[model samples]
Target: MKTFVKIMLAATIVLVAGLWFSNSFKALNNQADALEQPTEVIEQPIIEKTKIEPVKKTPFSETIVVETAIKFEAPLYWAVNDYGLIDGYSSTEELIEKYYLEFTEEQLARLFTEDFFYNEADGVHVTASASPNLIQTDRDFTITELNENQYQVSQVLYTLDDGETAYIFVDYIYDEVNNNWNIAMINYQY
Candidate 1:
């Protein structure tokens, strides 16, 4: 019985020592792995390519209404008639001065181009005048942009005496130096 007891004690001590040594070996391996240098991982920046679009220009067109009897229509009618009759004033300068309140010098010059007038005798005759019976109603004018710097204003008028329709087309060009719009052309039919 005594020899049996001593043999059992020796077996238990060996089992415990074996388990302790195994656990110590695992801990040492984990510490070594933690102390080692880590692998380098370089990250590249992400670049996204986007498409750029150009700005598009849009043309302008609109209908306008001048709410008055004939005040707005008188100046244009008088100018066109005087231009056709060639009896308003002597020269372009005189015409521009006379209508300076209505139009600018640059505008008058463009309306009466150099080819339209000749060096003739100076006359002091006023031959063209606006009729008292002419009337302008709502939506009587349409303004359209021909290009980036050019525009056309078309007007329609009616005669109270005979109920006749009249048409007027005026072209305007933007002058960058003068910072204003000048009359490029005028055409009318009564």
Candidate 2:
């Protein structure tokens, strides 16, 4: 009777386990089937389209003409080359003639030494062709006397097209006969 009871208990446990495994397998199969089936996609409702009007362009002939008066003060010092482009005043004479600098011919002659135009090995040659690009028409210069006969004139000069500014130094010598100063040397450092 004990052996029969043990066999019946073991059979009942096996039967319960089999039923559990079968139920789990059935659940997985159902999930797999659900995944394999085609999904139904719900269509989104379409929005109503609004009509857009094209922009009308003004005709050249019928366009409104609005004239604005713009007052521009002419540069105190200005010159033009043969080609009509804005050019720099080349000489001390030109500077005076264009009202850029206030100096007389006798004063200029005394101040600008022949060696003033000399190009040192390290200094840039301030020639007529190179003059236009060296300094802007609107720059102001500061002149300070160093000694009895020597003066230092300095200015922040700018390049015409490039808009580059440089510190320019001009050493001048006072001539008693002419009663004015002359440029002894000139150089610029950027």
Candidate 3:
């Protein structure tokens, strides 16, 4: 949506600028015709009256250019809250629940996967044992907000007992085509 809005804004500005330049050129041409004489090119008076000396214009002046209003892509901040953890995915069941809602047709087209356990959700729960039980688990993941229409995620894995840990950045793509969020892809160990 942000991209769409930006493209629209650019197109509108270009159209307006084109119209303005066209009108200005037409007016300038009309004025030139009315003058009925070649335009005069006058050199600046280089002699300062008080100094009474002709000083050559210095060519050392520098210029500064600034863009005041144009905006680039907004910063990619995580949609997650504090502590760098998604507060909800504490167990296998919870993870499954979160994953299922996230894979609907309203959400599937945007998602990609590398896991061996690929399954579909059709508004009903599939076989219970087939899905990973939300066993006692702890994982780390990064959630980044890529605009109103996109998000990227990285996964972090942790052990259950000894506090040993490993890191993974699972890339996720978010889409808004079905008026909802969907996964685009996931590289679990990336």
Task: Write one digit per residue (lDDT tens) for candidate 1, span 52-101.
Answer: 86444323334222322233334344433443434576665665566432
TM-score of each: 0.34, 0.29, 0.25
The ten-residue window of minimal lDDT in model 2 covers: 62-71
Where model 3 places Cα greater than 4 Å from the true spot, the runs are: 1-140, 146-148, 159-165, 168-172
* 1-190 per-residue lDDT for model 3 (tens digits): 9999999999999999999999999999999897997778999889766856554432211110001000000001211433223333443244345554443222322231112122333221222223221111233334566665455554455444766654443222333433434434433331
Clashing pairs in 2: 111-181, 111-182, 111-183, 112-182
Q: If both were scored by TM-score, which would come out higher, candidate 1 or candidate 2?
A: 1
Task: Show model 1 residue runs off by greater than 4 Å.
Answer: 1-92, 97-125, 128-139, 159-165
lDDT score, residue 84, model 3? 27
Worst 10 residues of 3 by lDDT: 64-73
Score residue 177 of candidate 2 by CA lDDT: 52
Q: Report the lDDT tens digits of candidate 2 across residue range 1-190.
A: 9999999999999999999999999999999999999999999999999989654432211011110000000221233433322344444344334432222233433343232332333321233332222223245556566876675656786556778767867565654554544444556778
Q: Arrange candidates by TM-score, highest first: which order? A: 1, 2, 3
Query: Model-by-model lDDT, in order?
Result: 0.54, 0.46, 0.38
